[model samples]
Target: MKNRVSRWLNNEQHLAYSILIPGCALVLVFAYLPAIQSLRFSFLRYNIKMPGAVKFIGLENYQKILADAVFWQTVGRVIYFMTVGGLLVMLLALGMALVLNQEFPGRALLRTLVILPWAIPPVVNGFLWKWILNGDYGALNGLLYQLGLIQEYQFWMANALAALSFAVMTFVWRYTPFITILFLGVLQSIPGELYEQATVDGAGALRRFWYITLPMLSNVGAIAIILTLIAAFTVFDDIVTLTGSYPTFYDATKTPMIYNYEMTFGMGRFGRGSAMAYLIGLLLFALTFFYIRMSLKKED
Candidate 1:
């Protein structure tokens, strides 16, 4: 038995398995176990308020969700936010990266300061923006009034479009810095030789950027765009903090994440909520898979 134990411990494959087993177990317990439980719940009729009434309902929850008009509206809103917010983030990040990549005094300080917004916790960032854009005594209102831009303080969050647009701006402000840093790092990694070669060929600065910089950054750009879209897709705390999740604000700012919270906790419809979670997870997975396929094709 002693000899057998020694052989088992000495084996390379056994050693590798031993090293990985704990990490794999932790992931299974912490990540996948909950997901599996949620998937099981998705096919049932479970209510938190009436736990005893749990029963198998098959795909009824999914069917109800698919046919729900409000769900479709939320989907449209998510798509809008993803497209607009993601585009703005990428554009702003790229521009900022270009500017920051240039040599300048205090460049290091500026780069460090730019990361501050991204470092703020999501909930805190939401609250900060909420106060800044508040109708009464808001910083924005005061600034605009002081500048004589408006006769009176505007209720920026009152109108649906206005609220959504502000939310998008806030998202861009918080996320752009991180993406900028990402692009900046990629920019710094690029070979200066390529630019020198292009210059020798009589290529102008714009042409060098267009031909070399843009092409080199394409892979990271694709990743950043998808990540921004994913973040926008599941946005919750920002809208909730900005609009307070009041019934009046639901139509204006409720994303799928907010709707899921309402269903699971507010309405105590656990099963339906689980189904919604699964659906959203599937959509996110599809987006990630699409990104991977595009990336692989690009490499090929």
Candidate 2:
């Protein structure tokens, strides 16, 4: 038995299975199992209010989600948020990365400072911005007043448009540093000889960046875009901290995640909530799949 066990452990296939088994088990337990459970729950009538009425009503929950005007509105808002906020984050990160990639007096210190925001927890970042943007006693209002930009303290959160803009700004601020780090690493990996050769051929700064740097960073950029896209779609803690789930404010800042939370915990409609969650997951998966396919096609 000892000889047989030793032989099995030495076998490459067995060793590989032993190494992968733990990780596979973790994924199965934490991801696949919960997802399957949620999908199952989505088909039932599982409201906390109606405790004894736990019947399987096939597609009813999905039907409600599809027909709900508020749900559709939330979907539109989330799409808008992802588009505007994701672009801003990527652009700002790229710009910052370019600046930081250069030789400077305090380049190291500046890089550290740039990454500080990304290190902050999402909920904490949200609360910090919430205070800064507070209408009556906000630092922003005081600064604007001092600058003579406004005669009075403005209620930034009271206005729906302003609130949405601020939320997007907060998302961009928190995530930009991470993207910057990603791009910076990619930028550093690029061969310096390419830029030197470009300069020898009379290439200016803008032309060098456009022709050489951008093309080299294309794969990294695509990956960053997909990551930011996923993060934007599943955003929750920041929105919750910045804007509490007030029904009045729902029209402006209600993301799909927020809507799911409101339904599942706030209203105790587990079935409907599960359905919405699945729908969002499906949409996200489809979008990511489409992007990956397009990217692969281009590569081919």
Candidate 3:
């Protein structure tokens, strides 16, 4: 039996090598390599100034992080960002999907235009919105003033609420296209006869959407939501560009991941920074696990 198995694998050597090579390389470079380095570095006191003073302090980094309140505050900010951004982005995407799914003039053009924000890089998107929300020459303030809506331009990023709202808006703009594209694909997949039958039975547009369209799209919507949630929680570049601890220097808008980068690179605490990165990774993995478990239980 052992010889037979070896013979089979040996006979399919080229095919097995092709499948294993790329996947194994990725695991080695991305998953296992950095992880091993992080584990070793987390236990030691590493800094650029004292490269020779590296010594194992065994959990000191974790203990110090635990004593820091700013870390927890940043965690709170991440939760708020994920929850609020997820809801608004999904809603906006669903609305766009529904509108574009209809037979209307310029629908195709509108669909293409709506997805532009998502196609842009996060850093660019954030700065673009920052410009649009600028106190002096922002398009928003200019338009409002022209409409006689406000007497003066508001300093949007100066106020905490406005800054946070603008950051959330950037998130929505970048992610909504992802939602819209997914929902549109699912909408296109749905059979047209369902809509025709509903209309024949005296169903109006609203009724058809609620009964036929919505029900058909629910599974796709659920999957889109999960994908968006993951993306929302993992967001970094946009927040860093738009806010970057904005409206304040310390913990004003620090996501955990950004905090980790600052700790490692900016503050020169390599060991602690690596630990913080690991903590963020663990939190993300836990959140993903819990969500998947709950979803499975609900289906059961």
Candidate 4:
């Protein structure tokens, strides 16, 4: 028995399985277990502040979430962010990638500088933008004043649409670098022979880029769009840091994630919060499925 056990342990497959067992177990405990608990709580009246009052309340929380006007408004704001912010990010990233694809002096330095914003944490980026957009004494205000663009320092975040626009801008500034890198990598991989052949065939720069560059980038561009939309859905840190997570739903900058935080922690209604999370997850899953299907159809 001892010899058999030793042989089993010495086998390569057995050793690999043994190595993976710990990690698999950790994921089960830390990730899957919590997810299961959250799902269960979503169907119950599991108020953390009133543990004794916990009880199964099937679909009640979900019903409330579906009917909530504030929730729908938050959804609208999410759509705005995804569309506006994603468009800007895609354009800027593509432009930067095209520029970086060229051979020029200090190209490496420019690439590094382009990627610098992606390195900053989301919350930190939010605070940085907040300072720049501050109403009282922001750098933007000072600059505009100096340029005679405005007679006085403007309250950039005072209006709802303006505040949301700035939030989207901050998100775009931070995320565009990563997408640019993605586009640049794919751009670099396209064979130079294709461009040369097109040039020899009397194709202009515009025509060659249209025929070669755009087609090669279609896949990555779709992926980048999906990623940007997903990121917009989960924009909590920036909103919280820039606009302050007020418990009220009237705050224009309150994204879905912030609403979830308010419901769960702020109100101690874990059940409703979990339900909201699952609803958000459902929307994300649907969005992803639809977008991917569209991309695949376009490819076909």
Question: Which 10 residues in a row give candidate 3 its minimum summed lDDT?
Answer: 243-252
lDDT of 2 by residue, 116-177 (tens): 99899999998998899888899999999999999999878786777777888899999999
Clashes of each: 0, 0, 0, 0
TM-score of each: 0.91, 0.89, 0.86, 0.92
Tens digit of lDDT per residue, candidate 1, span 1-300?
999988998999998998899999999999999999999999999998998999999999999999988888888888888889999999999999999999999999999999999998878888898888778889999999999999998888777777778888878888899899889989999999999999999999999999999998998898888788888998887778777854566567778888888989999998999999999989999889877976786588
List runs of model 3 lying over 4 Å from the truth.
1-12, 15-19, 202-207, 245-250, 290-300
Query: Candidate 2 — which pairs collide?
Result: none
Cα displacement (Å) at residue 294, model 2: 7.8
RMSD in Å for model 2: 2.6
Ranking by TM-score: 4, 1, 2, 3
Q: Please name the candidate that would achieve the greatest TM-score relative to the true structure.
A: 4
Report how far off residue 41 is in candidate 3 (Å): 1.5
Residue 86, candidate 1: Cα error in Å is 0.6
For residues 57-144, what per-residue lDDT tens digits would candidate 4 score against the true structure?
9999999999999899888998898899999999999999999999999999999999999999999998898889887899999899
Better-scoring candidate (TM-score), 2 or 4: 4
Off by over 4 Å in 4: 1-9, 245-250, 288-300
The local distance difference test score of each candidate is 0.88, 0.89, 0.82, 0.90
Residue lDDT tens for model 3, 1-300: 998767766777766886899999999999899889988888889985679989899999888887879888878877887889999988888888888888999988998898899899999998887778778899999999999999999877776556666777789989999889988998988899988998899999999989988887777677677777778777888878876635472256677777888888888888998878778878778767866865675476
